[model samples]
Target: MKIKVLIADDHQLFREGIANLLFSAENIEVIAQAQDGADAIEKAKHFKPDVILLDIAMPVMNGIEATKKLK
Candidate 1:
C-alpha cells in the first residue's frame, strides 16, 4: 500500500512543492494539506495519515505544539 501523508505549512508554494516531490514517489500519497498547526491536528485526526510534513514556525499553534498534541 502507498504511504499516506499530510503536509502542513504556511507557505503555499513550499507545501505544493513538497507535495509534488512526494507524488513522484510511487509508494507515497499526499492525503491532505494544512495551513497551520491547529489545522494540521484536525486533518491528522480526520485523515490519520502515516506521515506528516510540518513547518516548525506557523500561526495558530506551531509545529512543536501540534506534534505534542498529535502524539
Candidate 2:
C-alpha cells in the first residue's frame, strides 16, 4: 500500500522541502499540506493520511492540541 503523508508546519520552506523529498520516494505520497494546526487537523480529517508530520507550535492551535483532536 502507498504511504500517505500530510505535512503540517508553520514554515512554508520547511514543508516544501520535506514534501519534495517525499515526492521522490516511490512508495510515499504527500496527500496534503497545512500551515497551521487547525488547518492541519481539517486536512487530516479529509485526507486520512497514514502519517502526519506536524510542527510543535503553530497558529490557531498547536500540534499537541491538533493531535488530541485527531486521536
Candidate 3:
C-alpha cells in the first residue's frame, strides 16, 4: 500500500513544494496539508495519515505542542 502523508507548515509555498516533491515519489501519497499546528491536529485526526511532516514553528500552535496533543 502507498504511504499516506500530511504536511503542516505556515508557508504555502513551502507546503506546496514539499507536496510536489512527495508526489514524485510513487510510493508516497500526499493526503492533506495544514497551515498551522491546530489545523494540522484536526486534519490529522480526520485523515489519520500514516506520516506527518510538521514545522517546528507555526501560528496558533507549534509543532511540539501539537505533537503532545496528538500523542
Candidate 4:
C-alpha cells in the first residue's frame, strides 16, 4: 500500500515543493499539508497519515510541540 504522508511547514513554497517531490514517488502519497503547528495537529487527527514531515520553526505551536501532541 502507498504510504500516506502529511507535511507541515510555515513556508508555502517549501511545503508545496516537498509535496511535489513526494508526488513523483510512486510509493508515497501526500494526504494533506498544514501551514502551522495547530493546523498540523488538526490535519493529523483527521488524516491519520502514516508519516508526517514537520518543520522545526512553525507558527501557532512549532514542530516539537506538534510532534509531542501527535505522539
Q: How does model 1 fare in lDDT?
A: 0.97
Each candidate: what lDDT?
0.97, 0.94, 0.97, 0.95
Kindly list the per-residue Cα lDDT of model 2 for residues 1-71, writing each as its tens digit: 88999999999999999999999999999999999989998899898999999998998898999999889
Pick out the ten consecutive residues of candidate 4 with the lowest summed lDDT: 59-68
Q: How high is the lDDT of residue 33 in model 3?
A: 100
Poorly placed runs, candidate 4 (over 4 Å): none
Residues 1-71, candidate 3, lDDT per residue (tens digit)?
99999999999999999999999999999999999999999999999999999999999999999999999
- Clash counts for the predictions, in order: 0, 0, 0, 0
39 Cα displacement, candidate 1 (Å): 0.1
TM-score against native, each model: 0.98, 0.94, 0.98, 0.97
Stretches of candidate 1 above 4 Å error? none
CA RMSD for every model? 0.4, 0.8, 0.5, 0.5
RMSD (Cα, Å) of candidate 2? 0.8
Which digits, one per residue and each the tens of the lDDT, describe model 1 over residues 1-71?
99999999999999999999998999999999999999999999999999999999999989999999999
10 residues in a row with least lDDT, candidate 1: 52-61
Collision pairs in model 2: none
What TM-score number comes out for model 1? 0.98
Q: Can you write out model 4's per-residue Cα lDDT over 1-71, one digit (the tens) per residue? A: 99999999999999999999999999999999999999999999999999999999998899999989988
